[model samples]
Target: MGGALVVYESMFGNTRAVAEAVATGMARVAPGDAVDVIEVGTAPALAAVDADLLVIGAPTHAFGLSRPTTRSDAAARTGTGVLSTTIGVREWLEHAGAPAALPADGATPARRGLPAAVFDTRVLRRNLPGHAADAIARRLRQLGLSLVTEPATFTVDGYTGPLLPGELDRARAWGEYLATLLRALPLLPEDAGATGARGRTETPGTGRSAPRTGRPASGTGPSAPGSPR
Candidate 1:
């Protein structure tokens, strides 16, 4: 069996809602698998991640991933409900050191490069540019993790928003789609080699299997409205 961990950062809870919805969708499809949803502020170090899949989500700020300055600005707003004040996904990925090495006795396997997916929440607007998901996908690749799907976006009414109608349903559907892809791939054995095989997982959104050792999937851009806070 495989498990998934969803880590997210939110300002006014829109992204958190989407993250939970995605987790719910995955649970619905893979009822026997372990699915966890947690705020990025409380997430364990990347080296401590112990799952087959990693899903990350955040709100877009300044047309990209949020920074300490941007997060501060968001908190300064009059009526905002900031959820993460200290750390954001940007800092989390930046601080992810190399995976731990195998023990001298070689009994336990070193951490494998887990398959990953990313999503973001931003405001709905005509021709608005930029996605935190895009930046997130880049960082995941830089960390040597392959993407199981393109970056996803869920729309919000504004910077601080009640999510637009049916966005949660759409998020759930995307999550279900991701779980199906995870089900198609074979899980690594307890004693599998450290250099695990690639191309074992399906391409994002396509049912076809990826080529072995092929380049990680790249995002085409944001597919829907998302958060701007």
Candidate 2:
């Protein structure tokens, strides 16, 4: 809860900008908190995410996560450097393993249920059927990560464009809210360096889901092949 890692995939830099803004917001609330912002291309798999809080963002491609074809189309259209088409948040989560460290009994560490949140950049005008953010959130939950917020979106002007006005500010605000939420929650015994993995079961209500408000780019964002599990 004192450390946060933000991983994002961006072709036009919109999503990366949002990720920085969110990190800035988190810093405002917890000045001493550790925060790492990583781009998907250079980012390690999700299992390697070693923070108490994990925040992920990507451009909403087709309707969900970006696939090989969409990523290629984006790089070609933008003429900007793109990461490997085979790798993104979706692919990272797909093969993510269990936590690096566990309790002596080999039980899932109480901290294994790390708090997580997801966001995406999308076109404001075109309404998409699915969301990369939602897909990422669901995958994190499947990995036993706690959901600190629902899928959130920041708006972009068009396919490859400037972010909508004030979206960065909103993202900062969201980060601050996430920090406050993390602070108010009690840490698990193991999380506090206790001798064993002992704590109450963390159910859904323990984490707060943020409300939906905006969209991102239309064609330039990530689109999952299907709905989130």
Candidate 3:
């Protein structure tokens, strides 16, 4: 295989560790494929650059996705304002000028149409919030990426989680599986190198509308769409 990328956002470092395990699994299964793991905040904005697969993961926050920082209307225990919608932390950042902030990064490598998957570590107060995973998978699929397991979930005891004992193994298993699957796909068309169309589609997690014509309106603030498949 040519290459693959794993982009992740983690709070307690468990998720980052899990990402490393996942990458190792990928390398194990696909000996020649290139795998790069980076924190979401530091990862160059990745869009249309194509890879054989991409796996996105994070921690669950208040029935949604987590972020390193937040702007909730009301203060929360995490120190960021709570975002009370279907939107997640990354989407919020997207609407919060993620593009202009990337003055130094060239177009990110695309992983369109590959076998993409998503996961999250959530406090087990409830079964596990699914939207965070769906939100990530939906973003990948909007680029026509294939999905594995409608995204998956990893668990822990409280809001700030260590993801139980074996979740990192699970993540690695997922990465290995995805890498094996990606071997079947062809290289991207030469033209699919730039960022894929930056518009929203009917995300499965929330039928919440994508930004009108690929752009968020002023003050709308990026939020995850409410629950859906």
Candidate 4:
């Protein structure tokens, strides 16, 4: 088994809690695996030679991956300088030109073939049209990470949530499951045969599954345990 890391970004406490749960799950299922959970910006050294599987978490923002509004986050940074950075996070990315060019990394090739997964926290759309979790999943696939497609949806009765009661437990389960996979990295059971495949376990909000910061978009229902992303 290889050492694993669970990295995440959360605005409100909901996504952070989910991240922890996922980390916990990884530890439980793969006791032999080393698991380190870190928040987004404070992520461990991804460039480390010892690093193996790379796990990520984020909220679905405005129908997409919630980023700092930078021009380009994952793609901007070069091996050692700003010229090679993914600067599209908080700034207007359009100026860089959607059809424009991205910085080329002379030190490392694009992370086009890494293993990755995405999880999201969101408010119910009353329909599937606003399902941002799926969007997060899709983005991860585009980045060339092997898709585990374990995207999840968190319940938000209204904006700031009470989490509909059993949210924490559900979060814990997610963590345990992730630990299981990380422990057996590069060789765990495929999503085709287990927990997430055909309703083997009870999830937080929706079955098809589905964080945080500066008060995300508001929800319309009852109060949730935390805020909606």
Q: Which candidate is the best by lDDT?
A: 1
lDDT of 3 by residue, 75-113 (tens): 254554322324343763364243333222334444333
Clashes of 1: 6
Ranking by lDDT: 1, 2, 3, 4
Cα TM-score per model? 0.76, 0.74, 0.61, 0.57
Off by over 4 Å in 1: 78-80, 98-112, 186-229
Please report, in order, the local distance difference test score of every candidate based on alpha carbons: 0.70, 0.65, 0.51, 0.44
lDDT of 1 by residue, 30-96 (tens): 9999999999989987767778788999998998899999998888874645899789999998887
Question: Which digits, one per residue and each the tens of the lDDT, describe model 4 over residues 1-229?
Answer: 4566666655545566766776676667667777777765555333331334556665545555555542133223323322212311112212323221222231332233344445555554554344344554444443334444345556554433445556566666655544444444444433311123221123346432332111111211122122222
Off-target runs (Cα >4 Å) in candidate 3 are 48-50, 67-89, 92-114, 185-229
Error of 1 at 107 (Å): 9.4
User: Largest TM-score belongs to which candidate?
Assistant: 1
lDDT of model 4 at position 1? 40
Off-target runs (Cα >4 Å) in candidate 4 are: 44-50, 67-113, 182-229
Q: Model 4: which ten-residue window has the lowest total lDDT?
A: 212-221
| Tens-digit lDDT string for candidate 2 (76-113) | 88655754445777777766754444223324323456
